[model samples]
Target: MSIRPIEPDDHAALLALWRRTPGLRLRPEDEFVPFCAYLQRTPGLSLLCERQGRLLGCVLVGHDGRRGYLQHLVVDQPYRAQGVARALLRRALEQLAGLGVQKSHVFVLRDTPESLAFWSAQAAWEARGDIQVYSHSEESP
Candidate 1:
């Protein structure tokens, strides 16, 4: 698989890949367009992994001039365990470091095994003391 920067042309394929992936909470196609626009305009960066002309995985790197945040890391089920996710992640981290980011963080849902296992297996990932996750309902004030 080859990893490369995400392009405007890749938006549809990436969104379809996410929807087809079992573990992901799918979002509408239009919902991704604005985010793509933001990535195109800001310092944010995203990458796509393709094999034999088919999109296999993707990763997004977001930073606020300080810590780096990793999001939307999804590898197609057929390509899982073939190093696609790892390659995308390695690329993201390298790019973040190149930008002088001191630290990086990724938030995984509590019950997502693929995410949990991936992060847990990384030696650099550490869980600090007394971490709490906060969430709010969409209808809440």
Candidate 2:
């Protein structure tokens, strides 16, 4: 698979990939158009894995000057376990290092076993076992 930057034209394919997955957030296709535009303008950071003119997966790496966020990493089911996500991540980390980013962060949903396994297997990534993620929701008074 070839890893390349996301193009505005790839929006439809990206949307379709997400649609095939069950229980994923369903957003209007138009909602993602602006995101593609933004990503193109920000910098050439996001990478899309393609094979035979088909999008296989994607990863988005966003950063401020000091730190980086592994914003989104998703591989098509057929492409999983083939090192697509790993290659994407390695590229992102190399880019972040070039930009002088000393620290990086990614949050895996607690309920997803796949995510837990993926991150846990990364030898270079320190697993902060005691770290707890919290959130608050407000209800109408």
Candidate 3:
């Protein structure tokens, strides 16, 4: 398998992957226009893993000049437990560090047991009990 930076052309394939992945939650930001805009906003930070030109796994990464955010970390079911996710994460963090981003966060939904387990097993990541996240949507008054 090989790892590479995500390009605009990969969006369709990625969407298919995300759709099939059980635990992923897609939002408006995942649509084509916003996805491309995000790529433009933070270039070379998102990535994919593939073999023989087939998409195996992917992770979306970006930073706000202070902290990095990771999203949509998914691997094909057949490819799980093979270290694909870890490799993607390591590479993502390395890229963020290169951009002087020292800290990163990934928000996993409480309903996704598989996702929770995967993150819980990550030795380098810590579950934050001291902080709570609140989000406001523009669509919501």
Candidate 4:
């Protein structure tokens, strides 16, 4: 698969991809305008994998100067076993390193067993076996 920077125009394809992919709870397409905006602001950090013009996978990476965060990693069902996600991750890490991010983190949902196992198998440093994630959305009261 050809790994390349995601374009603002790719948003539609991504929405369609996310709808078909399991293990993802995506925001409504109308609520996701910041995607390409951030990708434009950060440049090169978010990427997509395609082959023969078919979308295969994608990853979104960003940082706060001290550390990097990865999100929205999804692979086409047909491309799962072909290393598309791995390639996207490798490229993201390399770019994050170049940005002077010493540590990188990925937030995988507990409900997604396949995603959890996929990330755990990478031997993430420390592999936080006992940590919990807590968050409150802006709409939460």
Candidate 5:
């Protein structure tokens, strides 16, 4: 498979991919616009993996000038276990390091066993148990 940076044009295909993937949760109310803004905020880190002109995987990585974050990572079911995820991650980490990111983090939902397993296998991934993660919606006060 060939890997490259995700373009604005890839938005639709990426969204569709996420829809079919099990672990992803897409937001409602014109989420694409916000996603575009995110791309503008952190460019060149997101990536797509494809073969024979068909998208097979994607990795959304970015940083806030200090800490790097891997927001989304998914490989087409057929492409799993064939190193696609690893390649995408390796590329993102290299880019993050070049951006001067001292540390990186990724989230694995409690329900996604595959994702948890995939990240757990990586030597660089440190699953935090002592910390609590809290998030709220934009509509929340």
Candidate 6:
């Protein structure tokens, strides 16, 4: 398998992959225009894993000058338990470090058992309990 930076042409395939993956959630930001904009904004931080021209998994990474944030970490069901996620994560963090980003975060939903389990098993990651996340959207009341 080969790991490579994600390109704009990858959107459709990635959307399909995320849609079929049971625990992944898709939002408006995942649409084509915004997705392309994000790639332009963050450059080569996001990545994909492929073998023989088929996409196996992907992770979306971005940073706000200091802290890095990761999203949409998914591997094809048949490819699970095979280190695809870990590889993607390691590469993402390495790229972040290259950019001088020392800290990173990923928000896993409380309801996704599989996602929780995978993250819980990661030795380098800690499940934070001391912080509460709050968000305000102009689109929400």
RMSD of each: 2.8, 3.7, 1.3, 2.3, 1.9, 1.5
Candidate 1 residue-wise lDDT, 24-78, digit = tens? 7654423667766657654446888998898889987778889888878999887
Model 4 misses residue 13 by how many Å? 0.4
lDDT of 2 at 95: 81
Best by TM-score: 3
Order the numbered candidates by TM-score, best leading: 3, 6, 5, 4, 1, 2
lDDT string for model 3 (59-137, tens) is: 9999999999999999999999999999999999999999999999999999999999999999989999999999987
lDDT: worst 10-residue window of model 2: 21-30
Clashes of 1: 0
What are the per-residue Cα lDDT tens digits for candidate 4 across 20-132? 87888886422457776678668878899999999999987788898888888999888897888889988999998998887988888879999988887786535676888
Candidate 1 segments exceeding 4 Å error: 27-30, 41-44, 135-141
In the range 1-141, model 2's lDDT, one tens digit per residue, is 798877677777877876775434443323576667658654777788989987888876777788787744778888899999899999888888888986888877667677778889988888778978886756648
Better of 1 and 4 by lDDT: 4
Q: lDDT tens digits, residues 41-74, model 5?
A: 7887889999999999998887889998887698
Candidate 5 Cα errors over 4 Å, as ranges: none
TM-scores of all predicted structures: 0.85, 0.80, 0.97, 0.89, 0.93, 0.96
Ranked by lDDT, top first: 3, 6, 5, 4, 1, 2
Pull out the clashing pairs in model 5: none
| Model 6 global lDDT (CA atoms, 0 to 1) | 0.95
In candidate 3, stretches whose alpha carbon ends up further than 4 angstroms from where it belongs are: none
Comparing 1 and 2 on lDDT, the stronger one:
1
